[model samples]
Target: MKNLKQLELLEDVLENSSIILPITINGKRRSEIEVAKDTSKNEIIALAKEATSKWLEEKSIIKEIYVPNKLVNLVVK
Candidate 1:
C-alpha cells in the first residue's frame, strides 16, 4: 500500500491472477487459544476455508477491470 502508483498499475495488469491468496495473519495470531485450542486440525483448517470464501468474494470486484484479451509473456532474465 506504500506505492499507490504501483498498485494501480498492477490493477491494470495481472487482473484475477491472485484469486486465491496466501493465508496471512499479520497481528498477534488473534489469541490462538480461542481460535483453535479444543478443536481438531480439521477444525483449524475451517478458518482458512472461510477466509478463502471471503477472498473469492473480494476477487469478483477485480475481475471486472478492462484488460487485454490475449496473453503476453514477459521476457524475464
Candidate 2:
C-alpha cells in the first residue's frame, strides 16, 4: 500500500486554515487546489478523495497534501 502521510499531517494543518490539493495529469502535476482555513478536515478529505477518485477514472491522478505552518508536510502519494 502507498504511504499516506497526509492523514497524519491533516491534523496539524487543520488548525492553520489552509490545505493543499495537488492535481496531477499523466504523472505530472498540473495545478493545485487550496482549501480555505474555515473548511473542516473531514470535508476537505472527503472532497479531495472524491476528486482524486474521479481523476483516476479519467486516466489522470491527483494527490492531496496538508502543510501546516511550514513546520510539517504530508503527502498522499
Candidate 3:
C-alpha cells in the first residue's frame, strides 16, 4: 500500500498530466512501461504484476511501488 505522501503524488500526476511511460526498477535492473493517464487502476496493477514476474521465481514479492517524478520504483522482497 502507498503511504500518504506517495498517494498524494500519484493523485497529482493522475489529475494533471498526460499519458506516460514510467521507469520501473527491479533489483538492479530497470525498464519502462507505457501507461495512459486514463488507464484503470486494475490495469495498472496488472502491469506492475507483469513487470515484476521475473523476480517471483526467486521468492520475491513486490514490497512497494510508487510513481515519483514519473519514475516507477518497484521494490521487491
Scored by TM-score, the top model is: 3
- Winner of 2 and 3 under TM-score: 3
lDDT of 2 by residue, 22-77 (tens): 64444455455577656665666565555556444534224444443221112333
Candidate 2 TM-score to native: 0.33
Pairs with backbone N, CA or C atoms under 3 Å apart (clashes), candidate 1: none
| Candidate 3 vs. true structure, TM-score | 0.48
Candidate 2 local Cα displacement, residue 50, angstroms: 1.0
- Highest lDDT among the candidates is held by which one? 3
Among residues 3 or more apart in sequence or in different chains, the pairs in candidate 2 whose N, CA or C atoms overlap within 3 Å are: 17-37
Q: What local lDDT score does residue 9 receive in model 1, on the 0 to 100 scale?
A: 88
TM-score of every candidate: 0.25, 0.33, 0.48
Per-residue lDDT of model 3, residues 37-69, tens digit only: 766655665676677576545655555565533
Question: Which of candidates 1 and 2 is the stronger one according to lDDT?
Answer: 2
Query: Which 10 successive residues of model 2 have the least lDDT summed?
Result: 68-77
In Å, residue 23's CA in model 1 sits off its true spot by 4.6
Off by over 4 Å in 3: 1-18, 26-29
Q: Across residues 1-77, which tens digit of lDDT does each residue of candidate 1 receive?
A: 66998998888666534222123232112211123223444544444445434333434221111112221111111
